[model samples]
Target: MTQELIRATIETLEMVTVSSLFSVLLGLPLGVLLVLSRPQGLRPRPALYRALDAIINVFRSLPFLVLMIMVFPLSRLITGRATGTTATIVPLAVAAIPFVARIMEQSLLEVDGGVLEAGLASGAKISQLVWTVLIPEALPALVNGVTITVINIIGNSAMAGAIGGGGLGDLAVRYGLYRREPVMLYTSVAVIIVLVQLVQWLGGYLERRLRRDGKVTASA
Candidate 1:
């Protein structure tokens, strides 16, 4: 039981890590574009902003379980399977894209406009302005947003096991629930609680450190 639990925990970690990577890599650009194209943004385009907004809304509105079912075909097509730790990453990442995008958009929106305007006045191109001013100014907030996304993704990943998407969820369902093993169930729950607590603490520490360093840099 211990060995199996350890294996399940590793699978959970793998799913979370890879999905978080994909979600962040793709979502960050969509988020940046959202900020750039908002009605009163660096380059306002209501039509584009609305379209992006709708797309993100549709994804975010769907419950993760439903989204998992909806994404099964895509997962099969991409990974040639939809029931294992590796294959489950497809839907997990897909479901997280919009979530990460919206979080990142919010983070970027919180950046001070003065920095962006100063960049623009200095003849910075849109790309340069985003790279130099918006992202830098928003880095601390962005990290917090990412921390939130990761925590949510971990929960979603566990839930994915309802569909045989392997992880601690699979362990809980198969051995704990199905086999009538109350101890297994309790252990699984305990491990999940521990993982969440650890992530929360680590994320808060990093965010605080980043903010402190940012303040020091500014003061210097």
Candidate 2:
């Protein structure tokens, strides 16, 4: 039982890691694009911004389960299977990307307008302003948003298990539900709690470090 639990836990973490990483990798750029191209935002393009915003909203509005099923064909194309750890990553990452992107866009929006104005006044190019001023200024908020996204991903990983994606959640469904094993259910719950706590702690610590660095930079 212990060995099986350990293996399942590791597999769960691996799926979560892959899904979350891909989501971040894709979402960050999309978020940056959203912010930089909004009409009232940094770059301000009407048509392009509206189009992107619509796309983001569409994905965000869909339920995860529906989204997962909707993407099954694409998942099979990419992973060559509609079920398993690798197969689950496709939909998990797909569902997470827009969510993280929206969070990132909001974080970018929270940056002070005055700082952006100052950068503009100083003749910074759009790209330069984004890289040097906007992103750096919003780093703390961005980090927090990323933490939130990661936690969401962790929780959503369980949903992946429903589609035959192997993980702790799959174990729970198989043993706890099908076999009526209370031990498996309780064990999976405990592992999820530990994972969430660890993520929260790391996020808080990093947020503080970024804040401290921002303060030191402002002082200097």
Candidate 3:
């Protein structure tokens, strides 16, 4: 039992890590694009902004369970099957990208206009201002946003288990609910709690460190 649990835990962590990486990779750029193309942004294009915003809203509004089922066909197409960690990555990444985008938009929006002006005053190009000024100024908030996104992904990964994406949650559902194994259920639940706490703590610590670095001021 112990060995099985350990294996399950390792596999589940691997899936979560992969899902989280994809989410960040896809979402961060989308978020930056959203912010950069907004009305008050460096280059404003109403049509483009609205179109992207609509896409983000469409994905963000859907419940994870519904989205999971809705994307099954796409998942199968991408992974060549619709069961296991690889298959689950499709929906998990799909669901997370818009979420991360929204969070990232908000984080970048919090960046100080004054800092941007300063960058422009210093003859920095628009791209340079964004890369050096906006992103660094928003680093702490963005870190927090990323932390939130990862935690949400962890929860969603559990839902993935229902569709045969095996993880600790799947273990709980199969052994605890189906087979009435109370010990297994409780153990999985405990593990999830610990995982959540660790991520939260690490996120908070990183945010604090960035905040103290003083490289960029909140109003800069």
In TM-score terms, which candidate is top? 1
Candidate 1, superposed: residue stretches over 4 Å from native: 213-220
Q: What is the TM-score of each candidate against the true structure?
A: 0.95, 0.93, 0.94
Q: Mind sharing the TM-score for model 1?
A: 0.95
Residue 177, candidate 1: how far off, in angstroms?
1.4
Query: How many backbone clashes are present in model 3?
Result: 1
Please provide, for model 1 over 147-211, each residue's C-alpha lDDT reduced to its tens digit, 9 standing for 90 to 100.
88888988998899867888888888887777989888888878888888888888887778778
Candidate 2 per-residue lDDT over residues 104-156, each given as its tens digit: 99999989899899999999999989889988888889989889988898888
TM-score of candidate 2 on Cα atoms, chains taken together:
0.93
Q: Clash number for every model?
A: 0, 0, 1
Q: Against the hidden true structure, what lDDT does model 1 obtain?
A: 0.89
Candidate models: Cα lDDT each = 0.89, 0.88, 0.86
Instruction: Rank candidates, TM-score, best first.
Output: 1, 3, 2
Position 116, candidate 2: lDDT: 94
Cα lDDT over the full model 2: 0.88
Instruction: Between candidates 1 and 3, name the one with more favorable lDDT.
Output: 1
Q: RMSD per prediction, one decimal?
A: 2.0, 2.2, 2.7
Q: What's the ranking of the predictions by lDDT, best on top?
A: 1, 2, 3
